[model samples]
Target chain A: MSGAKPKLTTSAMIASLAAEGHRTSGAPFGHALVALAQTRLDIVGMTADLAKYTDLHVFAAAYPDRFYQMGMAEQLLMGAAAGMAREGLVPFVTTYAVFAARRAYDFVCLAIAEEKLDVKICCALPGLTSGYGPSHQATEDIAIFRGMPNLVIVDPCDAFDIAQAVPAIAAYKGPVYMRLLRGQVPLLLDEYDYRFELGRAKLLRDGADVLVISSGLMTMRALEAAKRLEADRVGVAVLHTPTIKPLDEATILEHAAKPGRIVVVAENHSVNGGLGEAVAALLLRNRIAPPFHQIGLPDAFLAAGALPTLHDRYGISTTAVAERIKSWL
Target chain B: MADPSTVSRRSNVSLAQRAWRIRRNALRMAAVQGQGYIGQALGVADVLAVSYFHALRYRPEEPLWEGRDRFLLSVGHYAIALYAALIEAGIIPESELETYGTDDSRLPMSGMASYTPGMEISGGSLGQGLAIAVGVCLGLRRKNVNAFVVNLLSDGELDEGATWEAAMSAAHWRLDRLIALVDVNNQQADGPSSRVLGFEPLVAKWESFGWHAQRVDGNSIPALVAAFDAARALTEPRPRVILCDTRMACGVDFLERREKTHFLRVEPDEWDAALAALGEMPA
Candidate 1:
């Protein structure tokens, strides 16, 4: 949307995902957790050393006694959270999605998910949120966790979605793994007056030309792209699916089954085991094959660079999503 | 905090007799499946005996009592051992030992909390128990719930970096009510635990990690009672660990002399031999 922006710096690598001049909310997850902890006395917060980065420091500061800093050990973080949940306390744990998925996968699987504990694992930097390189990029987190049973996975669109999602995850009596949109997350869903359900997909906007099924920051980008596509006389629909696992198949089939619309699955994750593949498998199994296109990162380790340039290069930014849809049309 | 010595309803000899029963229960369960983690169960019997009879506080009829001290089995393979203790304490039915590790059985080869009452955490995946115990202790502290937490881990589990990480955090949090019983049987899946990864100066490692550490022969009922009492008596604002150096198949001479006894498939004839050995030990 920015036609004339200043020269982007390396700081852009870790800059807020919010577009310039867009409304943003700071630390929605941390603040929402603090709000939930007040009424739910059993609610406790925990994190590895990424509290400041994941914005859980807000909750930690507010509830000093209820917070547990488990150092930099992700395995221990997941295990301890599982343990806490066993003893009648609900633990909301935060860390980088990369560490939760890659580093402590077995711990989460055997300890939290298998036991069906009421532990909320909120991880930041899902997919390519960071520009620091492959190490910081959690491009395959969804793929890693999608196979784990008894885990409810969420990929909130922005700060407003996260704010609505925190309590929803806690209210549900089981283990959850949500992707956190930390510090200065974009607030787009609030414009639609959207209320997030634990496992529901919300169709924010509708059109006849194309239907964009998305989650995470890509949903925000898809909403932006829908507006940009309007100028080109293209009517685009944005279906925001925050809950990735146990997908809202009823709503998805209802929307995607609408006749004569090109179905596009966009995500801030790798092409492997993401929303694109998930939707594809769903549509295939249900015997409804629409003309499909996927806008996801390539199946490779992405290079380290400024997030803006990386987003455009990998075709996930608003400009890229719009351009790709227009060319397909 | 419940002072264990004050709450005891039995003497050391009674505790020893319970140990024999625990060992007998474990051997019976293993015989049901014709195989199990019998070596570890036999080795850690006395630790479990002291834990249920002395150090911990709980209602045998009510496994999920809110005031109950948690006994976490981090070495999930030792499910047979913990199940034996639970049965002795009247938490689980003694008759259920017949159905152990069988189809539609509450007892599985590995431990899971949902499968049985009094079984706190799902384990079998080593190196994760101490972390869960740390969390339980943290939760207890937050709720101002006066309950101690005990985590039983294997020496082989010490090789897991997560154990050390949780160990460090427990001490950092000054979880004075948390106690760890490490079954240092000197045996792991590969070989002797010390040679497997060298957790020697183990006491120093735990102390450096900010824990009050103690070592005892895990098989000796008197020594375990003393160690449990010491861990409970400590006023230090830090986590405590009782490193029980145990012999695999402690009371059974034939199995005890065997070099490799980690996961045993006891011959059909050895069940009688094992029960006979337990009968020989002084109660």
Candidate 2:
């Protein structure tokens, strides 16, 4: 899919993903939201003209009357969601990550987060997920939303996490911003039998050489990299931090406190203010600094290309992550 | 055509009196703060009075009643005005008026939904209220709840691009239950609204966006009452906007004529005179 049309619409992007044999995790979110709506009538879905792309079409198809199409207005999408929440209704707002973090930041900040409204802002195309370019790829969404008070940020690794997070965020009151994996997302964590608990970091594998702290798609890559690294006899432990805010510090510290362990934080976000900076700060504050390194995007706008090329170029692919860990070891 | 001067008919005398009390309550609250957005409060008092007393169907004691009509204060700085109206409507205690803008008071300097009981949104950031109103109306429609959403904004808010975005969506959604009350005091923080940003032909802007637009004397209790009635009675699937052309500090003659009254710093002696000008004296 390299050198494909750069300006494909969300639907066109999804079709391209299908052509490439990639499945979307948006299916689980849409399906889970619909299933939740079956028992909880207060669940309402909203989108900024990206329902089909974000897999909100599933919810729309299931409950057409309950879905609201707010054209291409991200600000109104957030503001309206906040307003709906004010009326004692839980609104699941879907849009691209860039639009939510960049275009509608203030609305999310003031109307939703300030009031601690129960608005679930689930955005697709988070961090380097889109091959389209910086416009579609939200590489710094976590950093942007990290500073916001009373907002729960989640970076789901696969379909299983996305499915469980939908009901979990709905049940837990207040505002939440979750990065979405759209259009044929790889199902990996379920193979590991991972159960996503909010604000809890899960230790998938334990090794002595290098401890890889990861979240979102980076975790999937880390898990794959660890398997390959095992063939090389490099002992690697993977700690997946799904919830970025209200981080599971005790769990992270317990795994990272060991001496002689190279602590590498992997993320699909920017090197600044993301999981890398967060873990670095935590280690520095706790005086548990091992030989630490961050594997993520550079602090700049990424070039446009296909997902495979971009992932390799940005050093987040399975092979790239494996090679980096091998070199560090 | 009805004469503008005698627009107050016999039937609207009670509404006019209610407007007067709202204005007095605002004056009292402004006195508590020593200084506040008293001019905008006075200008929008009649609209708030008609909204709470005549137009809206809210259970005053039960501020969060699901079946009640929602009134969003988009211009959060004008919270003093809404606080006065809420107190008059019994949604808030009359004693709390003295605690306005004080420490630990529910009534903050700006209108916040988390802080104030009756406030539908935290509206200090201008240009957010209408978009939120559109969302509320859409949510209400989905729930099969028959309720109106009245968004009260200032002329300065028109400068915000997001407000126009909401306007277009509200009309596109055919949200007849949404009512926008734009207080055109023609004054903003920087300078006059016209000087800062020209929003003239404001009614045409709304009508072109497919809303039932009406320009009314915001200070006239009769005009406000009729506009609210006409807005509610419209059966068309179009949003309604009552463009209220009002004088800042309207009820009191002296304050109404004062220049630079957007955020008035009332003198110690002037508080009593301002109250007296509204046909009341200090208690």
Candidate 3:
């Protein structure tokens, strides 16, 4: 074979995308997992032939003995993780959010959640992150997993939250379905000095004009929007909710109860049954309904395009979020 | 308690005696409710006896022992059969059989891991057990824990694609310690399993999937014992499957001869006659 070809940088490959200039936290899942595996001998990495995509290849390379490649079988992947959990092994299973929430929902329900097995389902491409259309994007993953009892749902904002969540969910006994932000995932939570506590929400910025509540990638956008709004004198409070299920109700109510503060729920998921609906229900039940609005994808199969176009079209991009908040104000 | 080797060395006569007790317990539990998957319980008694008494290495007192072999009941409706075996193995109390299918009873009509001791999985939906067994076997091997994973599923379960998926993975992983016992009772909810879903050439199917496959008379104590022995003796790095050919009702002649024994609802008067045919006095 000839000399190794120079690898194409992520920026060079997806140059037209909005994620070009931002510094990635460096595949937090793979790096954090590899670091975690060094200490926790029981932690085993598994994937359904998406190891490289889900960033489980990092763990696979570090500890080849512990990683299991279940091929393209999502059901088997989840079932095997459940089995490993039964045998006192903590299995960190990686796959696409669509496959985990849709393809292997029953296995996740019966084997892992129903049985309350200690299996961490860390899936990539949650919500509008993937531009590969409806088939690849898991826009309603949270909605699907929300109804499932005994399942901890985490939607990490960025690489820091993902890094923190890996160890946190691992230490917490039971099943967790964590949406991953893979590849060159942006780093944002560190700047805000945010720490991912399992079920609690983190208040990144405080403002009186609008309380911008968000999770996953939307939180990143919400923070960016908040900063831009400050220049325009639109005070926005950003409450980053990493844990969607067992949602941080106390903090949500505290922020929502404030007068003259418009409560806006932003998420990278579908408007139906995700953070928006969840917060709406919480507010409605608690009788703390301020001027409310939800910023998320429509209740339909998203169209295929690049990440930037999809985010802009779905109104989850930083620019879209800032403009929406400005228009509402 | 004797080791698995010593237990396996026990005569077929003793194993047959154990099978009779297991059948009687199932009968007792079913009679208490006046209905259950009695046919399945009675039919699978021989395999359960061979597994719990001879083939398996488990401490009945310590159900969660790490080194113990796991037995997953893939067919949830077969909870009666597993409960009977668990009772015989001393994992559960025999008195609990009276409270079968009752409120707050450990012996539910269907098997649930949360409620029942010695139940490896909460099997209800068909085709889930084999996949779980594959994972358990792989986990055990990784930990260097020498233990076998015995997955007991029905012929009806073969219709599930997940079962075939798991079969492929088990073989691909070379899990020699995994053994799948398919109870081909030929009965299911819709009707006969064959008509519901044709899983015939089942032996060839399993063999083609890279498993050491065999077919044996499930109700026959000697045959089941021999099959279990042969499966355990295979030193090759390949999973094993024992396709057990069994009738709906194996012990009670009346029930065995009855049509639609899948979910047999015996008359109150027939209870005594059924027990009498099995050489057991009705309490």
Predicted candidate 2 versus true structure: per-residue lDDT over A1-329, tens digit per residue: 58865652333353222223444454878888889999999999999999988889999999998898998999988999988887789999999999999999999999999989999999988888776777887889999999999999999888888888889889999999999876666776777757999999999888989999999988888988899999999999999999999799999998899887999999999998999999998988999979999999999999877676677788988889999998987
TM-score of chain B of each: 0.94, 0.93, 0.94
| Residue B89's lDDT in candidate 1 | 84
C-alpha TM-scores of all predictions: 0.96, 0.93, 0.95
- Which lDDT values do the candidates have, in the order given? 0.89, 0.87, 0.88
Write out the backbone clash pairs for model 1. B76-B124
Best by TM-score: 1
Could you tell which candidate, 2 or 3, scores higher by lDDT? 3
The fraction of correct interface contacts reproduced by each prediction comes to 0.85, 0.78, 0.72
Candidate 2 Cα misplacement greater than 4 A, ranges = A1-26, B1-13, B281-283
Off-target runs (Cα >4 Å) in candidate 3 are A1-20, B1-13, B280-283
Residues B1-283, model 3: lDDT tens digits = 5664344335454777788898899888888998889889889999998898778988777888888889999899999999999998888998898999999999898898999999989999778999999999989998899999999999998988899889999999999999999999999888898788888898899999999999999988789889999999999999999999988888899899899646876888887787788884322
Q: For every model in order, what is the number of clashing pairs? A: 1, 6, 0
Output the lDDT of residue B81, model 2. 91
Name the better of 1 and 2 by DockQ: 1
Model 2 TM-score is: 0.93
